[model samples]
Target: MSGTELMEKPAAPAKLGRAIPPAFQGKQFPLLAVIVFLALFPPLIQSDAYDLGLLNNVLIYSLLTLGFYWCFALAGQFTFAVFGMYAVGAYVSVWAARHLGGFWSGLVAAVVVTAAIGALTKLAFARCSEIYFAIATMALGSLIVILFREWTSFTGGYEGVSDIAVPSIFGYQLISGQSKYYLGLGILAVLLLLTVLFFRSPVARDLAFARDKGPVAAVTGLKPVRLQLMGFAVGSGIQGAAGSLYAHGSGFFSVEAFNIDLSLLVLLMLLLGGMVSMYGAIIGAVILVYLPEFLRDASKYAEVIYALAILVIIVAFPRGIAGLRHTLGRLVRRA
Candidate 1:
């Protein structure tokens, strides 16, 4: 065929029904299953308040971890300021709810403030990359923690903020464990859906391209900095939302809740779950959250066991638990 004819000809059709689109490939089924399970879970465990509480917490932190995955893993920004953003969201929400007369206002304020700060943070560190960027963000996160501790008038200082308002809608309070569980699960499901949708969108495509192939992305007319900042801002805002939910659910929070330790823990969760997959964040959050409870009776050995498990998972499954299915499939096919 002539070159023009060959170029004009439609590309060969993908194998019928086998060419899964990027949006749904390897993602929809598992997430759908999890969503269904979570949606139906609260009713099933109505009597098990303790377990419901744990599930609620898992949902809260999962949102934070997923936000981490968005900025750090997907956008390729090496930032650890998510914890700081979380604190800001929680404090702002609490303060707003108390002073502004409602939860809706607090929620909006938290998301807007946190997102603006995230964008500013990205701008401040626009020149830094890799380790330097990570260090800068970490330092900022720690500074935020200190600020929270020192700003007694605002954050309640060392004593922390207590008796923060619980979630209420139309004068209806969600006081019961089951109610909170559903609320958290609902928020988490929505955020997770948004995260996944973002991953499948053109923006995420460009961000991923910029992250993995900066030179090519630039050559293709993509603006890496803009995309990175968008990721950072959106991710931080998501963390902020998670934090607001956490504060309302718990009715109290201190600077300690958003310290560097929490940052590290959440980061570890991202790593152990698999940075490449959004589902990894969920798996990591569940395991880390539940493992502590499961090993609580071990007392002194609990931490050691936890550390050992992390090491084992990191060593044995470098790509994280999310990648295990692919690994097993490969081995089976080879055999």
Candidate 2:
């Protein structure tokens, strides 16, 4: 073929066959399926308030873990400020709701304030090494926890803030366990959808490049610092939202709820689930949350067994449970 003709020629059509829809491709189908299951779950166990509460916890922790995934996993920013952001979000939401006269206002205030704080924190430590940045954020988080503990007039000290306003929509209060569970599930579904979209977008690719090849990315016109700052802000904002959800749903919370232990537990969840996988965050949160309950009968051995189980999982599947599928597929192909 002539050069110009070849350049202008349309590609030959392939044989016609069924094509998978975009929604069913990659991880989208599985995410949709999970959402569907969660949507139906409340009706299946509506009578069990305890189980519903546990489900709510799963949803909440999933959000928190996803935030960690965004910052540490996606953007390569090691930060221990998750719980601090969570506490700030919760307290801010409560304060806003009391003064601003609505749950929506409080939630908005939480997300905005935490996002700003997150961005500022990143900017302030923009030049620090990863380890130092982590240390700085951790110290700041601990300081926040201490502030909340000592601020009796604000956080209610050790007693925590009580009589938190119930979250409502259009005059309808989410008073029942089922209602609260569905609310959390809906928020999670929306965020998961956004995350999926983000994963498919060019921005995610650029962020990944920046994270894995910082100096090279900067040399090639990618703004690594800006990307990391945005990631940190968004991630922190998500944590803040989770915190607001927790405060409103529980109607009471203390600084103890957002201590350093909570931050470490979240980090463990992220590590155990597979840092790079968004689904891993959800899987990790669910497993870790339920594992303790399952081992409740073990009593004295529970802690030991828990530690052993985590160690085995980490050692055997370093990439996490979500990565297990990929390993299995590789083995199948090799076989």
**Of the candidates shown, which would achieve the greatest TM-score relative to the real structure?**
2
Q: What C-alpha lDDT, on a 0 to 100 scale, does residue 251 get in candidate 2?
A: 79
What is the C-alpha lDDT profile of model 2 across 1-335, one tens digit per residue? 11011112344444386553322235464756665585666646556878888888988998899888878887789889898999999999999998999888999999999999999999999999999999999999999889999999999978989979898988999999888887888787777777776665557667777887889999999999999888889889999999999999997788888877877888899878876467777788889989999999988899999999999989888778877865667778999
Q: List the residue pairs that clash in candidate 2.
A: none
Whole-structure CA lDDT of model 2: 0.82
Candidate 1 per-residue lDDT, tens place, 1-335, comes to 11011112344446865653354344454655666576666557556878887778778878888888878876678777878899998999898888887677787788889989999998999888689988999899889989889999999887988868878778899988788877777777777667656655557667767877888889999998888889888888888888888888887777777877778888998889877577777789889989998999998899899999999999888778877765677778999
Worst 10 residues of 2 by lDDT: 1-10
Q: So what's the TM-score on candidate 2?
A: 0.89
**TM-scores of all models?**
0.88, 0.89
How does residue 86 of candidate 2 score in lDDT?
Answer: 93
lDDT of 1 at 333: 100
Candidate 2: segments with Cα more than 4 A from true spot: 1-30, 332-335
